[model samples]
Target: MKALLGLFILMQIFIATNAQRVCGTEIYTQKLFAANPVIKNAWNNAEVQIASTTKAATGFAARDTAANEIIYIPLVIHIVYNKVIENISDAQIQSQLAALNNDYSYSNIDKINIPAAFASLAADTRIRFCLAQIDPQGKKTSGIVRKYTVKDYFSPEDGMKISAQGGDEAWDSKRYLNIWVCNMASRTLGYSSLPGGLANVDGVVIAYDVFGSGEHVRAPFNKGRTATHEIGHWLGLKHIWGDAICGTDLVEDTPTQQYYNYGSPTFPHVTNCSPNSNGDMFMNFMDFTNDGCMNMFTIGQKQRMRALFAKGNLRNSFLLSFACDSTLAQGSALPAVDTIAVLSNKPLPQNTGLKVYPNPTQAGVNIEYIGTLNNISKTVSIFNVVGNCVYTGKLTKEKAYVNMANLSKGIYIIQIKEGSNRLTAKIIKE
Candidate 1:
């Protein structure tokens, strides 16, 4: 009887330890699962396509072949908080940007000291995350939206509301990536419903405490890597260990592990699927490691991420305007003018003036500025709607002619600059 009781107690300890490590904290699992039912219902209703396990294999392979391309992501940050501490500052948002760019580019990971075994597998994803300089509707936005809500925890449903309201204020999801930062219930540190999941929401939600500023948290861990990890999930990359021992994250190279890890783990911790000489990859970004200890995304993982850029609907929409070979034209090609005509139909800022002459020209288009020149300078450059810079030259006092004969027949922009004063004029190549 004594032996049986001892065995029972030992088994219970093992189960509890395994459970805590697998799902993070108990509170996190309960709250996160509670939200899963809603996502499941949404999926069953055909509102979202929850990717099945079979799809993971094909998705993994497709991403591996197209890893070299660049992905342009438009980011929107929604801050929901009750007070200032809950409300992160703009500088903090910028800091998050700096960290994300570095991590995604593998810049920060390269700085970490790692064994050569893992270093060789490290990849620098060519993707870049930028604040939406121009929104889907062609409105200018700083890309940060703030909301004061009494609610502290954000469920997947709340994620939907925030994305709808916050994104509407910025760019549509069809054009921008939405990221919501708020105080999560103490139950969960972070959770992301995958893109094709039943709870298919179009943004990422991070617990306010884990979002930014080390002041609210501890060092290294204080940085916003939580966003980095969840964003990976949002982009379709699964946890590096796979959700379960029987499950696979779908990357060919990452060894399977029995469960996830929380906090900092020692090196060479062997697992069932990773009993090799190098042991398990617990320090991977997808795992729950201290920020200082975590580094690197495997080449396989990079391929998976890049695949989302290639095929995901929300991701591909942002790439339509970001191609590399596109270029803009300059003003020296503008047709020589006997007289300039200013279009007065459109409203102009006070003291602003614009003129174009030699309406039908053989050589190029000529532009003359009057009034305050709106502080706009004489030098002007041209670009197409796709933001490619083609030509640039000095304005020569108050007049500048952009040579346009070489340019193809299309619409172009004449960007005038002086100090901080910038103005754009549209011209056509005949």
Candidate 2:
């Protein structure tokens, strides 16, 4: 009787601890794998293919050929909402997408926080994200689809990827990365389908409150890292700990971890699985840590994900997508290109106390420099809603004016760059 009582208590404790977890990808993936055994088979086959390609000489030749170029992914977001707040604004969606691009391309400013021990292991996936300018049918789109649902909330098990199930159906997952933003019950911030999942539902689903950085965003999970983490899963990266004790995440560079690390574990967190001084990489995106605590993807992880885009893989179709074609004739003109273009493979410098004022100005805004910005080859560029650079100018003074006389009434990004150093601010033209 005592043993039975103890077991019951332990089970309850386990349930409570799991309730605090912010990611449901593991559970969702397992459920999908069980429901469709073929999914698992496909995933295993894809892994075998990835191994063969990486091992063969032909793979090295292909990697070298396209190694210097940046691969841009076109994305489509489906906003499923019951409450008005769940329908996040276009600005919030853009912010999330910007965060993804910055993280994936190794341009996020916070990357400086990566500890020295694991710094070299970090990698630039060389992947950039852009909102789909054209739909699958060649029609112009805002890249955001908003749908009203009567359901109070959604669960990972629910058919949230289907319109008949009170959720918005995904776009062509092969062509466009579809993200569903809604209010998910429980603490699940988000979940994503892996590369070999059902094609129609092959995307990510995020809780609206945790989907973006600013409005309607919850603290600790508001930095848009949830989507970034889930996208890692969509791209074939596993949890840093591999969801088991001393488990292998299949990446050679990442240390074996005992389990997921929650909250902000200090640097050099030495678990039993990784007793070395360098410790487990609790700061990886795949861990169960808060948004602010996660920073990087290892080179091995990057290589694994990029393999999905290799020829004959499940996600190879994305390479043929022209959703981001700038010349495609459509409804309204595309927004300005993103500032701080993917100029080189170098990392972006940290922000140096530069600020843009009169953010929501109808006339013009002032660019305030805290220190000496002159005597350097620095340029100021403004990007419109669609990430096109509308204006580019040289900064000759500490305080400069960015004229908004010819700009439209919407959000724009102000980017200042000096060499590899880049700073950006969002401005609203009223």
Candidate 3:
């Protein structure tokens, strides 16, 4: 027992000293470029396009409207686990998604912690994330896939992304953000593929301990910012230091940073490279700070991300996706061509046709709908405030139990559709 306790203490010491917040983005990029020569051409072309866009939008006077447009990215988490604890709970996954949505859009409560000097530079990015409701085969999903594995852990080169290698195969890369969570071999925390890479291997891989917030998350990295930082790379933002001493991240507003900052540094922490400026933006999400310390993404970084989703850009396909629509339940096979057309425009009466009583439900609510046809395939979808369909099913009769017991407390839209008739109602989960 003494020996086991000592070993556990030693493990804690190792994790503290080598937190592995260092992203393997550049490392994976180098490996991919070497393995597949064609990737270099695509990456270079992407850079050229970004540069051209920047040139055209030079100076804040042009005042880009890109920030005004809200874009939602569908995410699917693949949990490859060896132990029972590694198969994290849905609440934990939801917590991480909440963190990503909040942090990426500058809605994080920690924004108040950022120094006043850097406040204006913080950007909303107008980006939101939702766990996919529609599977690639056009079936309903919880947006989480769990696979028990014999392998204790996985490494970057081990292809934790390949199903044949004891990892979950990625969903379609262009339409969804795929994240693999598992026990990482060695001290590595996480890694992500940059915007341009082989389609099959394109996504982010994060260690389970740092993948989310609350119960399953570990100390120092528990704020769930690890995934946020990695997704930043996946969205085309580089490290503030660009992985070198006195490096450039290609952003105009961020002061040049000398090196990545770790732990929590005092405010006004300037690097030698930018002695005249207000130091390094250590609190920026692109930095290597502990999750608690990192809070914001610069306006320049937002522009870079928005540019990637621009028309004709590599990530633009996601903007046209209909994966979260009610139509996924309309048929078994998705149409060959995807469309983002509006689903319905009919107005639902206030507590008339369908009644969702106990507006703020703790255990659950009774959804009673009247004046309905029988055996006509009545489908119900509950969308979160951000438009993510968290729950989907077919209403059996005139009434059903809309369970909010497991959902986080917030406002959600309950959408019911049957043939030509559609009804919408708001439900508050308390």
Candidate 4:
């Protein structure tokens, strides 16, 4: 009788402990859900809007045709550290980027060892993630911004601060997508505020451990997939299960699961959805799988991500047709052209001769032009390689002072335009 009582007591303790663990995890996730309600709601609403808008815009009877368009997301990584990891090296950043591109493009599955039963569902996201080579105003950049902060670890709110700092310090939210990488709170790998959200600060925050350079990081989580998952959120995707059993992730194909999974899950694990004869999609990136084990984003999830690139704030800033074309043209530019001309619709009238003095200026550049009084209403636009507009102003006089002291040593373009004539001059800021 004593043995039976002892066994019962131990069993109760085990069950209680498991319940507490589960509850704790839920509490942490709830904090994320509550703090980022804006993004959560926007994602839900965007799905409805996308469904209706795509149907109307494509004039097609099916969802697949509308989703076929390839999506290109330009990324900017902000590395905030306290010298522990003196900002992940560029090579490390590149590695993480490669991982993202492979996963989203469905190329990573080639590395996976899959059983025959679940093989047919394999999908390529048709989405590409690239470091922003050109900024919003058409300026060239490395796309990695590093800052030193005193704080040990950043909270979700602190994450917002870092992103805002990036925006203020040369990061362009309109063209280059911002990603904040820091040592965030304990037990938190990463969290993202989706597009069109209240905290939609145009960035995603990831914990250092899950980022690149796994030297000081732990196993089962160090392969940089944390950034991958957070980026999915940034692109308007939700957890595969939508955080509840009955809740839909809004993807038509992904199976509904009751809980999140950690570590590597064994094959053939059955679930309520019984999606495939094999079982639940615990190995999907949207799920909480170990980095090495998580390799695919489902076809449905891919459609949703592509759909996001089709509308809203992201589309306006990052998906403009001109921006896309420029990106491609610049990417293909070899031997690096000394000067490239970008003309606005309105050009300066004939007889306007624009001159930029000291072609390579150390202190400041002076602009002189001979034109009619209509030039007073014209504008001067300066851009760098990545499409970042460094300066813009209406022409007050034929002469303007362009301070170059604080500017980095690089090639810059200055354009002067009036009614029908446009002139471009290349100036080197040294």
Root-mean-square deviation per candidate: 13.5, 13.4, 14.3, 15.0
lDDT of 3 by residue, 183-272 (tens): 987767888998878789888999998888875688789989989998998988888886666777877778888777888999888767
* Residue 293 local lDDT, model 3: 93
Lowest lDDT 10-residue stretch of candidate 3 = 334-343
TM-score per prediction, in order, is 0.60, 0.72, 0.72, 0.63
TM-score between model 2 and native: 0.72
lDDT of each: 0.57, 0.74, 0.75, 0.59
lDDT over C-alpha atoms for residue 36 of model 1: 75
| Model 1 stretches astray by more than 4 angstroms | 1-67, 109-111, 159-171, 197-200, 216-220, 311-314, 321-430
If ranked by lDDT, best first, what sequence of candidates would result? 3, 2, 4, 1
Write the residue-wise lDDT of candidate 4 on 1-430 in tens digits: 5455345334433454211211112233345557877655765576686665444433444433234566677777776655325345667788788888878777774446554565566677776777766544454445665554445676665443443442223255556567777776545677765566543455667766567635544566667777878888776677776665534677766777755566678876677766556776777778777787777776667666666565453444556533333444443211112111212123432333444667677876776654433335667777675546677788776467667777788877776666433455667777
lDDT of 1 by residue, 349-407 (tens): 23234556554455687676556452234567777655567888777656656778888
Of 3 and 4, the candidate ahead on lDDT is 3
Candidate 3 C-alpha error for residue 281, in Å? 0.3
For model 2, the superposed segments whose C-alpha errors exceed 4 Å read 1-20, 54-65, 331-430
Candidate 4 deviant stretches above 4 angstroms: 1-43, 51-60, 63-68, 84-86, 109-111, 160-170, 213-217, 273-276, 311-316, 321-430
